[model samples]
Target chain A: MILETKNLSIGYSAKNKSKILQSSLNLKLKSGNLVSLVGPNGVGKSTLLKTLCKLIRPIEGEICIKGESLESAESNALAMVLTQGIYAHGFTVFDVVSLGRYPYTNWIGKMTAHDVQIIENAMASVHIGHLAHQSAMQLSDGEKQRMMIAKALAQETPLIILDEPTSHLDLVNKIEIIHLLHQLSRQHSKAILMVTHELDLAIQNSDEMWIMSQEGIQMGCPEDLILDGRLQRLFQSNQIVFNQDQLHFQRNHLLSKPIWMKSNSDGLAEKLSFQLLQKLGYYLEAGYKDCQLELLSNQTWQITKNNSVFQFENLAGVQDFLRNN
Target chain B: MTIRILLLSILFVVLSLLSLLTGSVWISPSEIYEALTNPQLNVVNHFIFTQLRLSKTIAAIVVGMGLPISGLMMQTLYRNPLAGPFVLGISSGASLGVALFVFAGSSLLALSPWLLSLGLGFFAILGAFLVMLLVLTVSISIRNSASLLVVGIMVGSLSTALVSVMQYYSSPQLLQRFVVWTFGSLGGIHWNEIIVMTLVVSFSIVFSFGLMKSMNALMINEDYAKGLGIKVNYLKIKMIVLSSLMAGIITAYAGPIAFIGVAIPHLARNFIHTSDHRKTLPIVLLLGSNMMLICDLISQLPGGTTVLPINSVTALFGAPIVIWIVIKNRSFLNS
Candidate 1:
């Protein structure tokens, strides 16, 4: 392993006995593999990444890069080989990525021809070569995210760590980012670790995944996780049931009755109903009873003649009031 | 590199001549240069150039170059454009130290001039160092630049208040000397004082160069600097120490020249657009030295031989340049 943490306990040591941000978190990254860390909110994913990067001093464990203790390893030497790109503010796309060459730079901080070439190559790697000279403040959120990744690539570090890299990205941007990480792992041989919410993409792309749970962190392959039933346990939400074959969650039962308008249009109301459900994570399926829509969690729709009734396991009685009346 | 150094040295020489020739004495340029070169042949001319003109000329160049470089270091370390030795209470600290020394009267002044200067330099450096350290600590603890600024200004006002108390206790004879010192005279600094100024400024500049890379990283972000193996806390302390030392020594000799530190580096920035200090610092020294020499010369106004305070002269020239730059920066940011 190029980078590994041994029985690591992560968090601030400000007060006594407060070292349990995430405990028993042992992780290892080989020289050139992509790994993603996925967990629910407040599960210490960021804390784990920061711990591995040595940004915050971890409590009650050792982190080693290339068999050397992280703390004892020389910062300058570690800087050249193991680096993370962090966003400060308002640096140009070029200006920011150029900072990756700082370790090789002289006291004057002048970039040589070789350094400039590397920054260019890094920008090209992320397909942000056109925005090289543009200010980062001008770029769209997706573009800026890519620019940040370009900066990490420019560092040319063997081990790269990212925290919630695709938190606010759209679906397309999310896929592109995962692809970019995949490219770096395969083509560039960078040991990539990213914290993400996209479990499906991570499970497919990663060689290993570390499941950070309230009980403890467990490491295994995607297939191993599925075989062991940890995958189902990981995303344990009552609203939907996961299909192992298709890798999607489906509504467990019927919601309100499906509204039939000549049985011709389901697209428009389906979109509107889905959007309304998103507001409170509850939605009405189309059912028949004076064109009524009701809220449900394990939502499904049973279509009737013209009216609709939504179904819920427990809240179905109260939420189905409109149809009942 | 040798050529650049030589050019600056020559520029210093030319300014010295202009400083002597441009005054109310109105010595012709030829007579000025000839008299300046062959001083032994002309006793009266020697007194004018050596005792009066040369002393002031050297003091202006030294403090001008010294103060701004100190200011540049402060700005780089603190990562604030408004930061400088004087504006942020570093110079006021030195002024407070001087006020104490001047209030103590002739007995303290009777100590070896270097001892008195060192006495003044130490406390001034201590005062400035304390303020810089406080600003650094507050800035780090809060991680906010604007609040540190308000704190710095309050610190300066507090130092001013301390000096005022000292001024109240001083005798009229000592008071006059103190007031004269406060006016910031390049005119009274002797050859020995100039030597001290040169030695202190050169040494501080050399020491500050060692911190160039750290300062560059700091310019990007504090976290970036820390990540790059620079101990951010240690780098800040050393910058504060070096800046205070240079400001303290110059203040000891030249009595707190105003605006040189605050204004010249802005001009240097306009000249050298790069945020890199290796390029920025040398240019700051050159422009600062030039501005002080010109200010010293322009200070010879037509007031029936009533000379204006050099601080007032510097404030007059320096304030507008700084104001213009600030205004220009506002527009630059907006557009």
Candidate 2:
């Protein structure tokens, strides 16, 4: 195991008072594995990650990195990518990324040839090599995030931790970042852990999952955790429900009357019609005698109910027709 | 980068020479060179050159090098562009210390001049240390850099007000002395005072160089710096002490020369085109020294017999540069 925490309790302590966020965290992360920590907001996911990175001291228990106590492990043993953005002005992407060599650089921080090579490799790994000359402040959020990840990669530690790496990114960028981290774990054999709100993406990409909630901590493979209903319990709410088969979340909407859906072609119009109906809180049956909906391949829709038939050119028209009827 | 550094070094030499030649005395460049090279030939000119202009030039260099570097450290520590020795009231704190001692009466002044200056230096450091402590404490509670800046301004106002109350209660002689000190003269420092100031500033600069790596890490984010294994609190305290010492010592000698601390780092960053202190620190040092020399030259008022205050000269020159930087980098500042 690259990292293991036994009976860890994480929280803030000031003066004579201490507040514990989570306790009894028995976690293990191995090389060549990507793990995601998912939990409800304020469930101490960040606290746990911070404790693991040694940014904040744990109130109780022990954290071991590569069989050594966390306190004994050098700072270069673990790399961290934080959520807070860089505030340093006028720094280029290369300058920011090269700072990862802080541990190896001399007192004046003169980068060695080997350190420069690692920096280049890191930027290339994140596909930001072309942007090395560009000022970091001018980069888009997604690009900046990738550069930050490259910095962590340049640290060349056995373990890497990221806090909400994909929080502000668009869907494509989010997938891209998670995919890059996933590849890093598999190809480089680095133990990677990320705190994320992207549940489906995390579940799909992560080899293991650490779910934190009111029930404390549950650790296992994503699939196992899903099967055991651990994820469901962690994210359960009045308005949203976790869909195990779909590997995503769906709103708990009130059900409408069931309708039969039929299509002339198994194409875009057919799939879109079913989605529209489901979104309108209607359940589709394979066939129903009293109510039937037909989607023609010519981008038309027809609804037949109780011996009446309505024809419309588009889905919106069909919705209007249904509302009038 | 090498070319830029070379150009800046050349500019620094030319400015230092110009400062030496452009005083109230009508000494030509050749005569000044001769006086510098052959000190035995002209005793009166030698006194004017060494005791007056040379000391003033060294004082400017020391103040220039010290303030900008201190400003750079404070800016990085607070992550605020406007943070500097003067803006954050560190100079004012030094002023308060000096004011208390100088206005206390003539008994202390009756002692040896060297002893008197040393006493003032000690008080200035105490005052600066107190203000640094207060600013750091307030910064802990306040996350916004701009708000901390406001707090600093408030602290400066309070110190100035305290100085004013002390001035009002003092004799006319003491009040004039305090007012002239506030005007900030570079011409009055002797070789002994300049040596002490140089030593203090050099120590701080060397200490800051050692902190370049941690400061670079800090620029990214504090948590990231910590994650990289930087001892954040230890580095912070060290920076505070170093910055205070530099600013305090310079203020004690130069009477709180303004704006160089706040402006020079920005100017250096613009010239160097990078915020990485590894590259920016040297540029800041050279540029700061150059700026101080230029300000001192302008303060001499060229054809006039009366010399202008160094503080006014620096403000007139420094404030506009700061404004231009703010305008040019509006987006970066907002970010």
Candidate 3:
């Protein structure tokens, strides 16, 4: 195991008192594993990650890194990527990544040839080699995130921890980052733990999931956690319902009357109308019998019910028609 | 990089020579060289060279190098572009020390001039250290850099107000002394004062160099620096102490010369197009000394008996550069 925490209670300490957020956290992260820590905001997901990385002292219990006590492990043995934005005004991509070699460098921080090779390899692995000469401030948010990951990779530690690494990225970039992290964990045989809100992506890519809450932390493979309904219990909310099959969330509301959705040709409008009906809690029927939503080829939607028809030019109009009816 | 260093060195030499030759006495290069090499050659020229111009030149160099380097450290520690050596009100604290000594201490204890200066230096450092402690305490609660800067400015204004009250109740002679001190003169530093300034500034600069790596890491993010095994709190305290020491001592000796601390580092970064301290430090040092020498020479108003105040000259040159930097890199303020 690269990291093992036994009965760890993590939180802040005040004058002569301690506030424990979550306790009895017994977990082991082995090499070649990608674990996603999932929890709602303020459930101590960040606290756990910080304790694991030794940023903050755990209130109780022991954390061992590579069979050694976490306090005794050299910082160079673990690499971390934080969510804070880099304000390196005039630093190039390579200059930022080379900082990861700080632990091994001399007091002056002069890079050796071996260190240079490692930095280059890290940039190449993250597919930012072309941006090595570009200033870090000039890169997009996604590119800057990759550069930070490359810095962590250059550290060459056995374990890596990232805090909300995908929070600032767009949809495609978010998937790309998760995929890259998954590949890094497997290919490099490094234990990677990330605190993430991307539940669907984490479930799809993570080898294991750490579900944190007020009760405690539950660790298992994502599929197993889902099978045991642990994931749903972790994310339980009044207005939001987690869809197990679709691996997403939907609004929970009263079901409307069934609507028979029909179209002469299946296209974007038909698919969109079906989605809208589903969102409105109206079940779709195959044949047009009682009520029907017909999508025409000329960018028009017609809703017929009880021998009356309503027309809509757009999705918003369709939503209005459904609400009125 | 070598070429840039070479050009800056040449500029430094030119400014130093100009400073030496362009004093009120108007000694030529040959005469100045003769006096520098052999003090017995010309009594008047030798006295002018050794006593006046040389000490002033050294003072300018020390203040120049010390202020900007400390300023760079401050900027990195706070991760704010507007941060400078005086951001924590160290100079105002030092000014309060000077005021208390010149106005109150002089009346309470009838001391010699030497002892008075000694007491002034001691009180200045003490006042600065006290203010540093206060700033550090406030900074612990205030996490935002911008808010901390406002706190610093408020502290400075409070100190200045207190000093003004002291001046209002002081004797005419002591008030005149304090006002002249506020004008800030490089030419007033004695050789012994320069020697002390050199020792303190050198120690602080060397300590700053030791922190260069951590400063580079800190520029990215503080938590990132900690993850890299840097003792972040220790580094922060050390930087604050060193920066305060430099700012306080310079203010005690030369009065609070403004703008160089805030302006020179920006100039260095702009020239090199890099914030890497390893690359920027040397350039900042060279440019800082060069700029100070130029400012000092300008203040001398060569060939004229009258001299302009050093602070005015520095501000005249320094303020515009800072405004230009702000305009050029407006994004930095947002960041």
Best by DockQ: 2
Place model 1 in a CAPRI quality band.
acceptable
DockQ of 1: 0.28
- Global CA lDDT of candidate 1, please? 0.72
Per-residue C-alpha lDDT of model 3 across residues B1-335, encoded as one tens digit per residue = 89999999999998888887787878898898788788886889999888988898888899999989878887887677777756668778889988887888456457765665677777777777778778778877877766887888899999999999998888888899889888888997866667777888999998888888888997788888888999888988898888877887788889988889889999898898899999999999999999999999888886688999999999998889777866876765544
Segments in model 2 whose C-alpha atoms lie over 4 Å from true places = A242-245, A285-290, B29-41, B329-335
Worst ten-residue run, lDDT, model 2 chain B? B326-335
Lowest summed lDDT window (length 10), candidate 3 chain A:
A248-257
Q: How well is candidate 2 docked (DockQ)?
A: 0.82
The segments of candidate 3 whose C-alpha lies over 4 angstroms from its true place after superposition are: A237-249, A261-273, A285-288, A293-304, A308-325, B36-41, B107-118, B143-147, B329-335
Worst 10 residues of 1 chain A by lDDT: A77-86
User: lDDT of candidate 2?
Assistant: 0.88
Top candidate on TM-score is: 2
* Model 1 C-alpha lDDT per residue in residues B55-81, reported as the tens digit of each score: 777777778888999988877766666
Evaluated on chain B only, candidate 2 has a TM-score of: 0.95
Model 2, A163-205: lDDT tens per residue?
Answer: 9999889999999999999999988899999999998899899
Q: What is the TM-score of each candidate against the true structure?
A: 0.83, 0.96, 0.92
